[model samples]
Target: MKKAVILLSGGLDSTTCMGIAQNEGYELYPISFDYKQRHRKELEAAKKIAEYYNVKEHRIISLDNVGGSALTDKNIDVPEYKGDGEIPVTYVPARNILFLSYALGYAEVIGAEAIFIGVSSVDYSGYPDCRPEFIEAFQKVVDVGTAAGVKGKSIKIIAPLINLSKAETIKLGTKYGVPYHLTTSCYNGKEKACGVCDSCVLRLKGFAEAGIEDPIEYEK
Candidate 1:
């Protein structure tokens, strides 16, 4: 069976990627990160989603918190949704970069053909790393930096949700029967999602647009 490494953040987007990858017939190897993030509940959510897929193995990587962003720094507060052009405080410093690097390494180790990340440019929280130029540049990095690339068998860095809006992503995931109930998108790390945070707001908005009820409880 063809294998793929999925970067599972236990959020809507990442869980959707899991569904897409499963639909594509790849043997799933989900990899989640524990970077001491403020929203650590997502880690537990990741476990549930992985189990829902019945993957061969779910790898959880524990990374040290690089404390510049609100996601990692306790001193900083998670702000409400701001659709402004500037990068938000929740943007983990080079988060996707670090995540992709780790996924690249794991992909090579497992002889996986591709790495799946669920990042969407549309309906996102103003994170610069989620943009196309960044993914393209990182593809270049993979092409030059990895043995797989040097051997001309480059591990493809795939972001299937790049062009899709959150509602579109939700619709697609629903088509694949993704267990959205198993995923969590709260940045507050509370048991009940803080509906006002950027992530929860985006999630709720997407479910609304998709004409789907958000399955999780929210502390509005």
Candidate 2:
């Protein structure tokens, strides 16, 4: 059986991608980051998703000290961009790179050849880390840095949602039987989702565009 590492964020996209991995019959290693985000509740969601899927292993690595962006800093504000003209304040600095690096390390340790992340460039909030170029660059890094790569084993960075729009992601999630109720995509750490944040807005739009009502409740 092929081993695969999935960057499970407990968000709709990641959970959907997890379904893809499971469907592929990959021995799953689901990894989530505890990166001091304001929405720590999402990590709890991640845990539930991991447990629900019965993955081979689940790891929650801490990135608390890697602070700077709005996600890591309590003082920083998450921006509500009506539309993207640039990267939103919610864009965590080097987030994808940091995530992939850790996933790479975990993959190496666990003898996995592929790492999956749920990054969408289309219909996105404009994070540079979500781009195909970034993933390609990181793939190069993975190929060169690992013992498996040096021994003719190539590491693949899988971004199943990279080219999909938010609506398309939602459609695929539905198609794959993803547990949307278990996913959370709010920027607030409160009891309910603040439906005004960029993430909440996008998620709401996704469900709407998919012609489906969201299972999760929001604090409008």
For model 2, residues 172-196, the per-residue Cα lDDT tens digits are: 8888788999999888757888899
Instruction: Return the number of clashes found in candidate 2.
Output: 0
What lDDT would candidate 2 get against the real structure?
0.86
lDDT of 2 at 2: 92
Q: Each prediction's TM-score against the native?
A: 0.98, 0.95
Candidate 1: 10-residue stretch with minimal lDDT: 80-89
TM-score of candidate 2 relative to the true fold: 0.95
* lDDT of candidates 1 onward, in order: 0.92, 0.86
All-Cα superposition RMSD per candidate? 0.9, 1.3
lDDT per residue, candidate 1, 69-116, as tens digits? 989998998898878777888889889999999999999999999999
Model 1 lDDT vs. the true structure? 0.92
